[model samples]
Target: MEKIRLGKTGMMVTRLGFGGIPIQRLTEAEAVKVVQRCLDLGVNYIDTANGYTTSEERIGKAVKGRRHDVYIATKTFPGDAEMVEKNLELSLKRLDTDYIDLYQFHSVNDMDTLNRILDPENGLYRIFEKAKKAGKIRHIGITSHQMDAAKAEVKTGKFETIMFPFNFITSEPAKELLPLCREHDMGFIVMKPLAGGMLDNATLCFKYLLQFPDVVSIPGIEKIQEIDEIAAIYEGPHNITSAERKEMKRMTDELGTRFCRRCEYCQPCAQGIPISLIMTFPSFVKRLPPDWYLKGGFIPEAMEKAAECTECGECEEKCPFNLPIREMIKESYSLYEQVKAANTK
Candidate 1:
């Protein structure tokens, strides 16, 4: 496995790292097995978050005595100094680590949040600096769902790494973000490398991302097969043919531009629906069949059907892209129900 330096964070990580989000779906034993497999395959970078349920605890259990084999990075979702400190403390305790390799400011969406985090008095920088001085964290980075906010952070020349969504579908903004990271000599970690399991062609997507210099794509893994597949991608020469590129463009166009970017901005559903996961059912079902939803028999029962919508419009009001999210959810629910009905019938 080849390693790339994570920007100015002064840590080198494998081109293929283990993402912590999807691990939440796995049992403790399963999660540990997959994470250890990642280490065995030379994947040294692992990212997790305090907000991701029990992901941190799983990583702590997985690494156990072999913590030195991987570079651990986790995010703090603290809004203010007090919360930031507490979040870090909890994350460190959960991960059973004394020092974090890279501590990121998690998912800043707009300039107001950015300004608040950058502020010295009541903001994140104070706590971040305090933590760094205390030797609890070695370097600072930022992750964002918005391209504009990520670009803004890169220009500041303060952060060592910048994580954002990047896939064959959203390669346009990535073209800009990629070069900017290189110019600043910052590590670019790509989340949603598969576009939330929408894009079926993982080989092409991973190959396309590798064309950019100094990028590390961490595909979320739960099953051992996923871990092995990603390991193959890292070990293989990630190159795309001209024909594949043409086909990729055609497929993405057909998939439409409104695919869930996995921004996680459409959260805290008033209905407690796990709206993001539910809304993305179609994409995942199409790409990765025999998924958890299917095995658990939740799709046909637990999901909210499109026709059941009461038009509360809460999701629409919060969407930043002004997406026709209500209509999309309606469309997704209907489509999913139809598929399930057909399969069973």
Candidate 2:
């Protein structure tokens, strides 16, 4: 709805880019309708990832004859040169486009991962450079769930844009990342602006984020109602009552500490469990349907595995966000067990 210069890339992307993750759950026909509605409403920036299961294919289909009108940004989780090259080709093919406006390294979390990406011999820089030369990718970018890693990447002066989680609760770090990005003339695309839908009132959050001059917030929307609501914010003055801000603060305080960001730093369970992925199930249930999770989609395989946690405190020490990993996992397991039992009848 609101338009801003996307960092150093100099493209005027709408403040509400269509985040592509949520569309993965929708059928192709449904996704097409939602995307078309977004187009009719003037929200033109579309961001997708190669990992978001058939999302690119759907976009390719939805935007078939109209691809050139919209800005397409897609990401891949490629850690090496070969993989990066492979992914780029695959993304291009899937989207039915020759060049992507922005191609980013997805879900980068640490310094080592950053180094591996920029390394000339083994990293993606060479691949990105080659792509740019060949006119396959117009700009290079990186996406990180962790602000620290994103900040580190911005310092390298290599990226045209940087994508990181930017929301009301996690905005403090932007005080640091934003200036560096502005100084370098790099674009800043924000992910998770709604705190993964925990921030229930999207209007205030969108307005709050638009006040920052150089940042763009792309809250993924799967429904036409959300598309219309976001578009409406653009036509009017962005305002939030003092009382509403207080309410937002209170709600975030209640949920911020307990919710997992899926950073996956606290891992390598002795019993081979996907702790971060399992913890996210509750949010997924809330986002989509309670039935799927209750029917066993979200149940942690760690029944005995979760019961095995000895409160060693090792995971807490490793977590970037300092999530109460063991406690949250236990809670998820218990809640899911009850839901699973109820669904059996």
Candidate 3:
């Protein structure tokens, strides 16, 4: 595995880091096994979030005796200083570690939220500074789905790293954010590298991302097979073949019209629908087995929520990718309803 310096934080992380989201769906033992496989394959950067249910605990158990061998990064949703402090302490406890390698403000979406978080009096940045000073966390970072917000945060030079979505489908980061990170010597972490599983060719995705030396893509993994597949990429040629380029174009064209990147900009629906999840459920249905889908929490609850979407157009307005969210919700609901009925039968 290839290693690169993670900006000013100074942690040398693997190009292919382990994302802990999918592990939430795995049994503790299963999650541990997958994480161990990642380590065995020389993957050293592990990222999870407090909001990811059991991911932090599973990673904690997985890295118990060998914490020094791996770098752990976890995040908390933006909040007041007290909430941020509380979550940081909880994350330390959950990870069974004295200090976190990198702690992030999770999913910061807008300028207003960013302003509030950077405020000196009650901001989470102060909490993170205090934590770093007290040795609870070594570095502070931020993850955002909004490119504008991420760019602004990067320009401030306050964060050690900035994580955002980057893939064949979403390449806007390449134009500005990528160069900005390099300019500032900030670590650039790529999330949703596979475009939330809408992009079927993992090899092509990895090849595309590997072309950029400064950015690290953390694709969520659950199975040992996923670990093996991703790890094997390091052994072969990293070049994107012409055939692969054609395939990438085909996939991009097919998915460009309707795919939801799960940026969560279209949130707080007036009808109380999880618009991003509902738009994304169809991809999960296609990628996962029926049993895993049932056990993995993609139940009819998503459909029930989708049914509540009143075609209010708020989600569409906020969507940066300009997805037809209302129409996508209808299609996803139809698919979920069919799956629900089949399972009941």
RMSD of candidate 1 to true structure, Å: 5.6
- The whole-model C-alpha lDDT of candidate 3 against the native structure comes to 0.86
Order of candidate numbers by lDDT, starting with the best: 3, 1, 2
Question: Candidate 3: TM-score?
Answer: 0.88
Clash-forming residue pairs, model 2: 7-187, 8-185, 8-186, 8-187
- Report residue 324 deviation for candidate 2 (angstroms): 3.9
> Global lDDT for candidate 1?
0.79
lDDT of 1 by residue, 168-248 (tens): 887755568778988998999998888877776778888888887578888888778888976786678767888998989
Q: Backbone clashes per model, in order?
A: 2, 4, 0
TM-score on alpha carbons, each prediction: 0.81, 0.86, 0.88
- What's the lDDT for all of these models? 0.79, 0.78, 0.86
Task: Give the TM-score ranking, best first.
Answer: 3, 2, 1
Which pairs clash (backbone N, Cα, C closer than 3 Å) in model 3? none
Which ten contiguous residues of candidate 3 have the minimum total lDDT?
A: 291-300
Report how far off residue 286 is in candidate 2 (Å): 4.2
Cα misplacement distance, residue 42 of candidate 2 (Å): 1.1
Per-residue accuracy of model 3 over 107-213 as CA lDDT, tens digit each: 88788989998887877788889889998899999999877788999998999999999998887889999999989989999998888777868898899998898
